[model samples]
Target: MSRSSRVVFYSLSRKFVQEKQAPPKAQEVIYYSLAIGHHLGVIDCLQSRLECPLDGFNRWVAQLPSGGAARRKLEGLGRFGEICIDSTHTHLLATALSKAAPLLTDEQQSWSQRLIDLLQLIENEPAIYLMVRRRDG
Candidate 1:
């Protein structure tokens, strides 16, 4: 990205981090990440939020720490091969799945599956689908 773009991303990232405590921008981050096809960014943002559950109206927001000096560090989930998600993350992931399921194309499904599997959900597992059902039911 250009120098100005970097400044804007950092500025927005900080604003969202703060907003997460009050107004919450978690879903926006998800949609943006998805729109840009930044799969790793999607997972990182989602995982961070799962790690630190927000409260109040902004409860949906996850708290991701500020990225380091290297600009690329902020763009994707580094070392994704070693990532793991706990029960809370699984629950959140399922929620995201349900919301995005209808709009997701086959190619996007392939991308979504990576995030799902990173959270340890097996492909085409009947039990995993139950999580979304439980939420919608």
Candidate 2:
């Protein structure tokens, strides 16, 4: 992603947090999509350290924004999608994800870090690997 794209994303994230009233559904969706994509990068990083198959990665991508325009623009660098769909190029993906971590809020930061910690756990824990699913369909 170019500097301009990162600027736009940061603007959107900050706008969502500063809104006086409830954000429009589209804005809400954008925030969560970006947040999930950012954190998934972190999980990809942890996967490489363990050298385990990230079988659940694709399942996460399937839940993200799938519209061609939205998918293409939001994922200009193909951060989360590439990591989820293809496992070989994960090191690059992890570096991209770590950069995005600081853009998240305190709550979002904690939630995302939890996923990172879970991936680092020595014992295999199914609960830790579970992805968050929104109820709206």
Candidate 3:
């Protein structure tokens, strides 16, 4: 999270995006993970907003108090592993993923806006809230 780290992550993320031949799904997963912390943060956020308990509410809630740092660490390592998984694969992905790490803030902001919008809908719509709660509660 230092200035240098941001530079490195942004550089690598841009590199990955530049590769025309990398698989779209793989690239998306990497970028999404970088942006979303493997959806762990998203899940935690959603869990908190819901009136009803999700299936893993207990487990998820437990993890939330710990912060997303550990999840981000594991996710970061996983990203590196993805880049290195295939020896035959092009190195573009690896390089992009490394430099792209810093772009996470951008993704987080985008997702935050989206979550805000969605939460607003949830707040205004009794039907949706009931649906989420009746099904989930």
TM for every model, in the order presented, reads 0.26, 0.26, 0.22
Question: Residue 29's C-alpha lDDT in candidate 3?
Answer: 61
Clash statistics: count for each candidate = 1, 0, 9
State the lDDT of candidate 1 residue by residue for 40-117, as single tens digits.
Answer: 343223212212111210112111222322212212222221223334455455456546555565644554455455
Q: How close is candidate 3 to the true structure, as a TM-score?
A: 0.22
The alpha-carbon deviation from the true structure for residue 12 of candidate 1, after best TM-score superposition, in angstroms, is 28
Q: What are the lDDT figures for the candidates, one per model?
A: 0.31, 0.32, 0.30
For candidate 3, the per-residue lDDT at 35 reads 51
lDDT of 3: 0.30
CA error at residue 74 for candidate 2, angstroms: 11
Candidate 2 minimal-lDDT segment of 10 residues: 6-15
1-137: candidate 2 lDDT, tens digit per residue? 22222111100102123335545765656555534654422122122221111222222223334553323332432344222212222233333334546555554444335434433331232222222211111
| Residue-level error in angstroms, candidate 3, position 109 | 1.0
lDDT of 3 by residue, 66-88 (tens): 34433343233323521111122
Task: Supply candidate 2's per-residue lDDT for 70.
Answer: 24
Regions more than 4 Å wrong, model 3 = 1-104, 129-137
